[model samples]
Target chain A: MIRGIKLGLLVVCLAMAWGFPAQPAGANSDMPKPAARWVTADHSKFEALKQDFKSGPEVTKACLSCHNEAAGQVMKTIHWTWLSPDAPPEAKLGKGGLVVNNFCIAMPSNEPRCTSCHAGYGWKDKNFDFAKQENVDCLVCHEQTGTYKKFPAGAGNPASEPKKMGPETFLPPEWNKVAQSVARPSRDNCGTCHFYGGGGDMVKHGDLDSSMKNPDRNLDVHMDAKGANFACTRCHTTIAHKISGRAYKTPAAATRISLLKDDQISRITCESCHSETPHKVDVKLNDHTDKVACQTCHIPEFARKLPTKMRWDWATAGQRDAEGKPIKKKGPLGPPSYDGMKGDFTWQKDVRPVYQWFNGSITNVMAYTKIDPSQPVTLAKIDGDPGDANSRIYPFKLHTGRQPYDKSNNTMVVPKLFGPPGSGAYWSDYDWNKAISAGMAYVDLPYSGQYDFVETRYFFQTSHMVAPKDKAVSCQECHTVDSRLKGISGVYMPGRDYNRPLNYLGWGIAAAALLGVGLHGLGRAVARRKNGNHDHQA
Target chain B: MNGNGNGNKPLYLYTRFERFWHWAQAVLIIVLAVTGLEIHGSYTWLGFKRAVEVHNFCAWTWLVLYAFVLFWMATTGEWRQYIPTTKRLIDVALYYMVGIFQGKPHPVPKSERDKHNPLQRMTYLSISLILIPAQMATGFLYYFYNSWALWGWGAKLTLSTVAFIHTAGMFGFLAFLVVHVYMTTTGHTLTCHLKAMCTGWEEVGVPPKS
Candidate 1:
């Protein structure tokens, strides 16, 4: 019997060993060996000859040997005329030629960095030959060859006999046709340059990284997974060579800018793919049509700049001591002072000051001004009151305040005068009636004297008094206005913060119970063991 | 070990109402968890939206049942069973920590009047009265945030803060689930306690001497 048991055990052990492998003791299993290196044929002699051959002349000869007629067509491309002797008069950067980028070290028009994206040869010199069809920089589209690694190795010999170019001289016809079909300029391609992560100057409206990772990020019609897969060119085909005049200025303009228009200037729109109904119920555009765009209200955080430094203290505003005297002295309506000291000053240059003001309980004023006294003053203000009828009008002011002072002594400063209190200088106020009467224009604060044409920038800071903690979206908001389909009736709507404590308590109870049961079971096991030991001794 | 010994009026420990509530809650919670996980795409035990709908329904039922149980306990004076006490608590603790492993007797006896061991009372009291109620409150707060806003609450509260509270509750639930599963395996014969929950009868053991 003992021998049989031993044999059976041996068989089981052998089976286990075969099923699961154990590496040899002390053996290292994970090191990777180096790959073999390759040696290349020597071409040192060709390198010397390369210096003597004029690359431009050689490239021209090569082009003429194959693409005689197509070379003329390629010359008409903007790539051929990239560099010009004279700068365009209409460029925004003024006569020095338009600098498309400012992040790079400022370069003149002749620099290679700028000209690389432009089309032309020997662009650094003013003698750029616009008529040269041979130097039309063909590698932009025909980028298969001339890649950094493949160059020189792939550069055909200058003296080699040229082969006749056929239809193959262009890209594969199928791929070329497909590329044309999907060729509208898309934000994706543009996004390579325009998106926030790409180091471009475009607006970073939504955080792309977080939005992409967010499981619940909203996907509108324009951003539908299927719709986004299509190339941008499938829609935006207008002004193909130059994108300058093709951008949409308004929501209405976007609808009109399609590829199907009689003017052949049409472009695709989001409405093409998405369901037309934006909301659960279609909202009709009445008088508010011009005032709002689908993107204006729905586009998350469109107008939200980072919260300006919070300065207005609502709790302290209009606060008084027991004696009824103002607890804190009020300063002038411009930049806030760090030390609470107010001083009279004059502008030394032309200045345009922007201001933000609240028409509600708290009024905050901020201004930027030129340091010179002789400059004209222009003012802009963003104004609104939460409870007023005309609460959202922002206005611009282009006049100087009339507060006079002794320029020589800089003393006996007359009380600072603002534009007439009801004039179009103040942006917002609590009186809704007055705001409407003023044609929703900004009015100047009241002041009594005349000053120079000094421009001061001001911003009115308003307090968002509504706290987020106390608000919740109720079921009724979705269900009441419509049918029962909107209501989630049987759902266990646990309070927002309740699950954690409940879960914690559940775990605590379970742990305590486990401890109790485990101890009891162990006790029983020990008792059995003791009994067995007693039996064995007997 | 005769039939006569078994006839000793099968000492009733848990009240009928208490047992009913316990079993009901257990069933509801299990259903909630299974369906909840399904809704989250953690598994495909059930279809997606269907699982979500079922989970929500069960959760509501559980909440309602808990409320009724709370009312019954309060009215019938049965809540006294969960009142925590220090008596024999240290002995119970030592039994769990050292004595039980040495084959020593249980410090607290299972009795007709005071059914819970000292540790049991504390655990049940905290879970039933404190944690569950807190979870419910927070969950409700999240569900009705917009309504709260309409009632001038949004003017004060942020949605992000509410979302944080909800997420914290989910973590707590997960922690509880882990401990619950581990404890279920530690009964006499391993499956003894589980069988008792199913049949509503625990095979009483002999009282240990002090």
Candidate 2:
């Protein structure tokens, strides 16, 4: 019996020691690849493409002849108007005209340089008309050729002349060739402006960068070149030239419109393709969708390929080299951490996104809006609460910075940063007073004599570059001690911080059991021997 | 009684139902402990996704089986065997602590009417009355977490507290399991208790006190 029992114990010990090997979870199913990149039609054969367009307006005229209503459709979008119809009448002028950002502050004073990213042409000042159809640049988003270039101080027009743009001789794009080579928007077309947001690459939106042009499956499974090869329109789902989703400004919730409702259909959400119950196999994961956004898990970290700007301090600007040129200092990551043209900046790569309960409503800071100088202004506030049914735990990139603001008026100020010499620009003259004064005069706003760089923070919603399911964040990532959800409040998670008294009780019981077992076994052995009972086990 | 190869008789101390309940409970407890510890972040060998599934399934199985066993024990009058008495309880404690090492006989006798010793009876009673019920209640609360807002007390209770109670219960179960396995080897033969659990019979001797 003893030998049998020992053998059984040995077998059990050996089996346990070998351990149960874990099977890898998640499927590697692929979505159907997109069609080849070649355009179906040759636009150069058309008579409209035969002429040498002298300016952007002449190119727009040729485009309007065939696609007459295309300019009208573009005008209605926030990309053109820069103002949402939902905004109050008091501040509905336009995002470019009134909205103040923490990065480079307001845009009113620096339209020539700022409008380089705008879809329309010649928005240099308040005098620029929002109703002009000819000013719309059709080739910006549709140009099939990669030669469409928008230079600084040209408003929205390509540099057609060999003009000197701050130390570089800028060559203009061939309008005749570019106008004839128009095709459907590609990654290059969208990335021209979006990738270089906040004046440089990977500065404004942490999740977006030039690396997304031909990403691998490891970088972004959805847009992988070797896999899905999805275009921007694949998810954005544009209709009548109006892109479905809006960033910087997002809706509180996706207002559904179908046979189920009569409300006007709006932007596309993650639920549009994934469906409300995304996790078909796991019902528990589906239940989590109500209170957790898909991006929170699927996209574990943002800025995976490159370092993104985390913070900037304009207070440290105006540093000059020995030759009196703007000083530039490179960080360990190869990006300029300190530039005399801007200020001090901090950058990070593979950053874990901050989680918050956001309902998607954003409150943007406008130029004329009053601000308390005592605290860092929230350039864009993500509004939501834990109790709100519409709210979900979403991932965000919080960019903290400092920018020039009107000390006397308690409002954010616009500074001229780029221009020719003697232009009263900060970069040209290094005079904050003159640059701000010129900027305020252009926007028809009063500028106080006293100016200072105030601290500010902007919140960016992370919505793209999703990885594969297997690459998604594991459960133990956020469910352990000192976990990712450490800063998040009002939610109870197991193994990551527990209640105190209950923990003590658990240990106490185990200790008592050990003592009881040892004493009982010893007493039983002693009592049996004292009774002259030679009977023994084992 | 039946005569063994060693000339010692084996008495039918446990019924088939009792033996079945004991073995079933032991298997269920072992399954629960392995999966439960994995769920508590002890190790990630099973992977959290699979561990949760196994733990929840075994918990339900154990709960349902225990309910059925309780009914069977009550109807068969076997529940009376677990009732504790002060008579010879101190003697049994002393016998285990010191008397057994000095070659003294066991204070209590093993019979059809009373198979468990006084210490075993009290321990089993505590486990069944206090520990098992507490764990079951906490486990039930955890399972129905979504419906917490519907009940007044449940609404006031935080999920962390519920999780804490459940974890505490798991530890108690672990301690009980360790002692139970060790005690099984202390019978007249090394495998005597295990054999009785399977065959419904145990080797016995005349009680010295009797």
Candidate 3:
């Protein structure tokens, strides 16, 4: 017993000398610094965040005290302006611009509801100052507290106090607490606007949804919360808050990033880290990189967890019951199939993506663009073909819809969809002519006073929800008859495409040779059998 | 020369080296045909990727064998043997077509200097000198399709045309194989020609030279 005690004492001494493996920096440390090595300073200690604030703009005023040039920098970004200057001027291509889409139409006469998701405050009209530094909502993106909630119809303003509207009670944030928690944008920050783009989760982009916030490895290998756990700022590496990536108007080409990341050409492409030849040298798949984008093979299907809105028919909207109340019908999936205010909707889960030859650019059909009434309007056209050197096969979610169009003008009409009782909104008055007239007057466009629902097709690129490498599509999926790439033209795939006449001729010759040889052998056998006694060996 | 089978002297129609290459060429051609057809998606036996690798390998082996054959033919003055002859060509054709069924003697038979008959010389010459060489050229062009842009005229060349020519060549080879195999049976006896190919000696029937 004495010897055992002596040995235990020696072991304790050795352990003490070496120091036990570090208890997590917070669990056992006497005093842990708030900021990590990467963060230069913690915002909680800043004097500007110590004061209580009245509004989100007041909080932005405080943030600007230290980050002086931040608002000026943000005003130039697409997120702040919602206008793509890179697009053709006549197209008026962006959210704030006069571009009409099948979903919610345009935002001109519907600012109160639509501007609630805007990065800045009080953008209720065309006169909302785009240059005001205090209007920037800094807490919406950077606040780690996650307490910020914009009022549903408050024009990008969070309530100063608890304000109940409909079913949701918008709670006012503790301004000091939210302001103190400022940092870089997280996945939740970007998801606030992007995930709920078409007014609900998984409504706009099939690849983006609330399920992506903390996905597992099976859903996305890169952004898996438990694995890589990469923040949005990781690949969308921003400099001066410009957020170096594509815009509403797609870029015509992708810039290759240097391996060291010092080249300043960070384009949020798969090639940013994975070069053009991602597969190892001599691999057959490596050769396909030139013709096929990473997303085409990596993301087999999207909306894995949630069913996304696939189609909407605005023509079937505005049905009321005997009591004059709005009607709603539940879909096969969880969401409502028909809402009296909106229309019929089709939702799909685990949807296979459509493919296109994309050079990164697209032709957006704007409100001013002329249309043919006989056919479905192509809202956006992917601009590339197999022959284009910049082109590669990319995957997309092709959403089809029917919305208001002008029969007289041969152009799409933006309907006033969201407003109060006297505002002549389509949802309120249930009148297409009144809503179209109000909407056309707001955008300063002439109303033809003729309205009809025309079918439209819109395409969104599938870049996220990338399944694991093991779940990628097999070779035979695209290389066989009735293949996934069946409708694609301008290139010949071997097993999928065969020259029927040449094949028939080649096979015919081989068959004929066999048949001829067999017949000749049979004839010689018959001749020998008939002349039984003749010795004709020579 | 007139009565080859009746010659009494024990004759050797095939040399040892010639028999080796002929049998080797037959096996190589069969391998190339099967793998080449598989690569064309005729059927999925051996799969696509394996078929291409194997086809290329067999084609290279055939080319090497043909190169040695060319060198041997040049040095030994045996290139003259493949020269086409109209001498009794029609008679030989008629013999195979009509007379052979009636048990008439062969119009042209294997001899010391002319193992290949008039018809054999024409068929073998065209196949070895024309068809196979054309096939090899197209096969190589198809294999190096990715490098087409490097060549001035190659950019204008379509893969479909190259592949079609190569596929047609495969059919030609297969047809040749069927007819050539059947013709081996039309000798003096069923097994005599096969025996000569194997042992390099022909047993000239019914007499012994003195």
Candidate 4:
């Protein structure tokens, strides 16, 4: 029998060896060179670099002289227009200019302050032309000097000269020097705006923060500065100034071997490099790929290095101190739980992700999208179901907050958050009516004259801070009692739960067997003794 | 081995292969039950990861031993011993429940060709025919779950249903084990049946005249 079993195993092994593909010989021959050697064009030698630029457009005019098509390429992008290209036509509110958000409401009346993050100049009002190519700010992304600082209310232009405001003096960056030192976009360039998304550092997407700029392998294996040393562009590969890997739009699955290759790849998913079956050591782990998402196990948690805003209540924005000045409240963590400029806020650190099925499509609520004020509004709905073959479990950061809504119209209301003193902005006058009217008129929407706060939630998918394999969420984390997937339904999880009737029936049968065994034992003992006494008499 | 002392010799009931298979199966079952209960979340004597490892190891061991036992039984004609009969099934059940308390004789006697009584044959048949196959088939399916679609069975049986069936078979094994152990104590002496299993001989009462 042992020899037969050995022979069977040997035949199976031989068949597998004959059927499997052989490993390629030189897998690393095509590895990319270091980023320092990638740039061959010397920008400092160009005559355009010798110009003394007075404003952001002046620098852009110099840049366009040599790189003739650069501005045109940027002009067609959302970064320059602040308008989404594929927004539903009837909504007319897909762009950042008209969209309402839980934090700071709308960008219409607050363009001067909000456009500081925009990659162009002079978006101070509705009159800013979307067709203007000269307004594209190249230094915002390519500046290697680390000195280009766009101040709030600058309308995308860096401070040209030192200026003073409220108790703080702002020093201008050397624009000529910065323009001369342009190179590929570094982590600092992307981190400048994205890291401070919702008015502050680590305020919006929980998975992103300033810490990612130089993360160690312990924090993120892919972007580890000492190991893989991946820049943001490594994954969000760009072509013709169009960056890929936007979470708002993604593919159902990744289908490419190389991220840099121009192929049919899921630009936003981990599967792009890992493939559908990444666990080569354990086939059992790979089997979970159809149902469990890579991030659900790999990410483990978000906001690892900083506390992110978990909740925001705009209704509490008007609170003031004894001196009638807006007051700030700090939570147990170092970050403020409430800022007079914003509202009541709650922050969290090292937060576990919420799991859900996503088919990589989202239907977001537009600015004028009719909403019901009676219940918490889903600002964006991830489209998928448990039954969808294309859908896989994904991790999400569910950001909850309250934003202004028109009480009479039963729709979301965008409020002007920043303006000059006496301009009737919420930050300046603490008046909701004036702010709402100004913001609503800017977007060509009607204000109902009466407004209140309505609870809102935004589902932000986590796609970064992937930990090492040893740090991934363990099997027991989702399989044991009161597991992380506790509230998740539509699928059965062994060890986490069992059929109650089946459990009772098992116990009942065992009890009956024990009862019969005990009674039979007693009867047999008595019968044997009685038979023995009869045998003696015979 | 002590007999009834009515001039009847002890019968050679079990063979060497049967004795080895029985003891090996008993040890494997005990290991399986210990780890199985832990994996089922009944208690935490062994941690979940370790419990799963031990359970899988024992399951594979039992599977290999089971295959060998099947071959042994087939070649030795011991497979016919477990063929169930309804002839005295009710009488044996009655003896256990009520008639035994009134000191009535046993319903059926053991023999070389038909070693098991009616109740023992039916119980063993159910275990070998229904429960063992259920566990083995379901266990194999789970172990190779990733290849379910490759086998063109994607929509047929879900992982949950397969797992439930395996757990149900485990419950059956547990009940059988308890009853089997208790029935061993029903021999002429306290240790009589155990010694018979170990020595391949069962001491019985006086034989009737031919």
Candidate 5:
């Protein structure tokens, strides 16, 4: 107790030294306005929600009776279409297009399994109507009750009846209870799909995980349950159901320097709220705000609460036990290292991010882009350099994997991985030839019969899991010989890099000065002792 | 002569203002070097953030002291004490090297008009006119590195180049400090020059006539 008081006193002294007031920020500000009501009317009293809803679409149909144009606005959004509006025709930059990721390869033949995270329902195949109003799954974003979750392989459907799959049960939410629970999206509403992306929890974006749902200030200052308690939509800010905060419509480092000019720029900028000069006391660090993204220093590292998938190797998969049973091996923290259906995996906790200059635009190899078989293929390459004014240093999760590619065609081969028995799925039959042929034909992409696994590198920008300001990366971390930015080039960093010959010369001259002085001082002392001996007849 | 004292009367060697600036610079330079080296990643004493903060504060203080020192030198004509001259330079060098062992006095004796010998004059002058300014200039540039573009030299200068020059200046200071401190012992008595710096008075062979 005494130590705590002493520490508090010391902090107060330091604060005085730095010329900062000891009081908390915003302490003397005007009293905050009373909490505004999120919804104008009680949702339970609405007659539309009182019906016995049979399916997911029936709930959407009822929602449209009052919200009328919500499905149309949602249909035009990236969440519903899964496509980047700014992408070129050949790039096919999202799920709705020909994009392929190394985790699950292409989603062509795996639509039924992958579409569980889709914003709408009944999108099982190419023929799923995009114009249908009832297809929008409103509960996925609006449901306050935690029970409203979709089926894993039911094409975004919730079970109309109480159905048991494995140890979990899926049922249509009760008409009056869960339907009435609809409100603005909570962290759970977003975390249900995005947190579990790429098949399981903490797989793709290491910066996002289940921990953010109920975070303290240490995990996230803004989204802390005990602190600010911000919802995802606070920054994402929707307009007619279309979210405006797409990451790279411009570059990630794009600046809208003035508040008056904010409408001309994209929504994902921190400056939209914080302004050009955010620092009041240590304005020196504010100079770095232009070249260094807030996340690069604030986050320091990601995947803190859970181990994220760092490496995935499909080559070592499909090994069974002596009795022909599926084998599963445990890894660090009991996360799976090898699954007979998946592959060898590596996981990392509290992983320091790879720092890079990004202008917001990421370069990617399209589904049909031929690549060198000898080199590791680039699934998503961070685009930037030191000279670009639009670029700023950002942190990334560089996830690598080894997945199948056509050896002859020089293009990636999307294998059919998730289907029942005798469906020619790689997981079911473990036959590479049958799976590759079926998947390529379904996606309508030409592929050679022969295939081989190719190593792939993908860079996912980490902008979430912002740590408290006090926990920001220290200057010594980058100013030392060993730095997190060792791989980055083009700009000189002091202490990390130096002019070897000049540095050596500097130390040598200093050493020479010391030696010269030492010898001269010794000579004076020795000569004085000898002269005294002669004079005094010692 | 004794080890700590010379068999002579006391004579004034420095003024009150000169003593203050000299001691202040000595202390400031030491503080700056230690904290600056910590920032240079040569060693860790104070943490990096604290080291940077202290270094900047001391640097600003040194600049203020430097301005005062210059004002005093300019107004009082004390700057002439550091005027380089070649007269008796070789003799002063020889006195320290060989003649000092034979009990020869300093080739250039101290007086009201000549505060330094030929060798000391040149050395002190070079440090005041060149080495110190170089450190101050480079340090100024380093501190304002974030405002390089505003100064319109951001395109021409890189951080590595600035740091390289600043590091070289740091070495010069260290070399001068070692020899300068050691030379204090080579006086009429071991404490003669040391005591002169502290009390602004030196025990000379004969007391100055009033």
Candidate 6:
């Protein structure tokens, strides 16, 4: 029994071991690997062939033999500056002198990766030293993999010079002397990087993932077919041997330049081949064109996101009560006072005061102006004792020479009006009630105007605010429209003015009517069948 | 099981105009709901632009039908049936809330004089008199925004408020549709009400008055 149990236990252990297995030994093992090397037509063989052709200058005899003046133009382009000895030290470091790319991982700046796009030799740091400057180096543009001279054309030895002419450069004895020139960078080559996963911070306007999946990825910016027949440099002419925006000066100018202007030609934009006018605005066909920007109203964001609500606030406008006190407390009283004066009262700074008023019930009436101290003041009203024989009138006129109300001073002036006798009524030209009414009306006009503009602009300004006249809108504009005033009760919209009960009642009635008619018809049908059967029996 | 289905005399009073309006309104409502949902991006069976066109067409059709229905109901004295009743209304409410769910029969009986259940009368009355009209008004306000501006009323009225009202109405309609669908399923065999809607004939049976 012990022996049998041991065998069964061993079998179970094997099953569990196989099911929940350990990682393979090869997975974690590490070993030194051979360095990678490129094998192709030997550079020595090509050099030897060139030595026998000591018939003319190297550039003239070897490169211009086919490229002609085209080779000379390429030398002046920004692409060539990648290897220029005079290029800024930071430019050689790639993006902003931070990240280094793997393609040009070594061999200074003149490696295969750098020379692949640059068209020169021995470019390291700021040193662009080239011996054979005019060698068209056909493999760079045509891709290193496929070449006619290296293939069907005499089956050139694979061990020979790896730089073989492409089909475009392959010339017959008669066509050998013909010259071809390419002035611009190819969109396809630019798209290779400008597309979804294109390296670097270029084209950072949202992810281009969906655009890359588009079948026309290989096409030019205009959505036209890019044949393998043309070279990238044909249209992307060299401007001081550098990419476009590297030459920008100001930060603002740099942003505009590097971000690709809407109508300008760039490797990533459709304006490269198509007309700069992206949209044909037939005003008759689309009446909305007068108010809409193509990018502003029709871009991807508009179709996806739209504002659904309007926001407004009115309580922040320094509301006051009938007692000439600021309404600031929660209830129908002004904010609590601590120093024999009202709470911290603040009125709108922009308001121009045209009138003022005071009470005439007390003999020692004092009024203080908060804004100005230098201006001479007049007593508009004063308190008086009733039935006193020596009573005096409350209203008092200011000296003729006193300065008019001066708004420049930031101090308050208190005007004291006192009399030992009784007085009944007091009056002055400064009417606070009338001034407040007028100011309220004026303020409401702009408020209502802004509200109306927001309503109308809602349809078009999906992501914008209705700015208050000249200033941008603030949160308080929409949130605090009806808040507590200083101390008195203020009437907003009163008495069921905006109530929606009628809406509910209307819906209820209509639905009831539909149900009634439907059921009544059914009832009649049943009743008619019963009545007809009874009549037939009779 | 006797010769006739009910004891009342046949009214034969439902005019051809009323029936036409009723059927057309029902069809247009279904079309509108389906097309409106498509516009909301719920489904893409009908492309967005095409769905919008259909929705607009149905909206106009419903508006025209509503006018005719209103005129017919007003002049023919048919609108009287929708007037509210206080007697036995609580019984009708209880029948829907608890009795119906318990498989107990409805308290209200179908007859030539009193066709609608009390709950049906109240709900339909609210929808027809309140919600539908408000939705129509708000919809028109939105559609004629330019005209409103030209008339100078646009300065006072906000389109966002109108949109809020319209969206609120849409929710009301959706709620009504949910109840209607559930009630339809509650009929005998689960499809009895659906068949009646399609053929204008419903099977009648005695309902217990509890």
Score residue B95 of candidate 5 by CA lDDT: 82
Off by over 4 Å in 6: A1-97, A100-112, A119-125, A129-538, B1-7, B31-88, B91-121, B129-210
Q: Taking the candidates in order, what DockQ does each have?
A: 0.06, 0.31, 0.25, 0.29, 0.35, 0.05
Better of 1 and 5 by TM-score: 5
**Which number leads on DockQ?**
5
TM-score per candidate for chain A alone? 0.30, 0.85, 0.91, 0.88, 0.88, 0.26
- List clash counts for every candidate, in order: 87, 27, 0, 0, 2, 68
> Which stretches of model 5 miss by more than 4 angstroms?
A1-36, A246-253, A258-267, A321-325, A529-538, B1-7, B205-210
Local error of candidate 6 at A57, Å?
11
Docking class of 1: incorrect
Best TM-score among the predictions, by candidate number: 5
In the range A128-208, model 3's lDDT, one tens digit per residue, is 999999999888888877778888778899886889986889998888998998888888888888888887888999999
Better of 2 and 4 by TM-score: 4
Strongest candidate by lDDT: 3
Candidate 2 lDDT over residue span B1-210, tens digit each: 111222356778878777777888888777777776666666667766677788778788878888888898879888999998888999988876665566555677677777788898999999899988888888888766756666766548887888887888788888888778777866655578888888887866333333
lDDT for each residue of candidate 2 in A1-538, tens digit (9 for 90 to 100): 9999999999998887787543222223342224444555678888987887788888898989888999999988878877775565466445665777767666666778888888989988767898999999888899968878888677887787888876977777788889887877877788888888887789988888999888888888767876666677766768789887654455734653232243244425677656667787766676567667888988899999999999989889899989889899999998998999888999999989998888877778877788998999998888878777677788899999998889999998877776666888898999999888887777778898789988898888898778888888887677666567777676776657676676577667778887887777766656656645354432
lDDT of 6 by residue, B128-156 (tens): 89987997888777666546657889558
Which model is ahead, 1 or 5, in terms of DockQ?
5
lDDT of 4 at A228: 73
Which digits, one per residue and each the tens of the lDDT, describe model 4 over residues B1-210? Answer: 112242457788888988998898899888887787766667776676677778888889989898998898899888888998999899888876765556445667666777888999988888888888788899889777768889989789788888778778878888898899997876655677899899999877543222
lDDT-wise, the better of 3 and 4 is 3
Model 4 chain A worst lDDT window (10 residues): A22-31
Candidate 5 local lDDT, A431-471, one digit each (tens): 88888888888878898888989999888888888888889
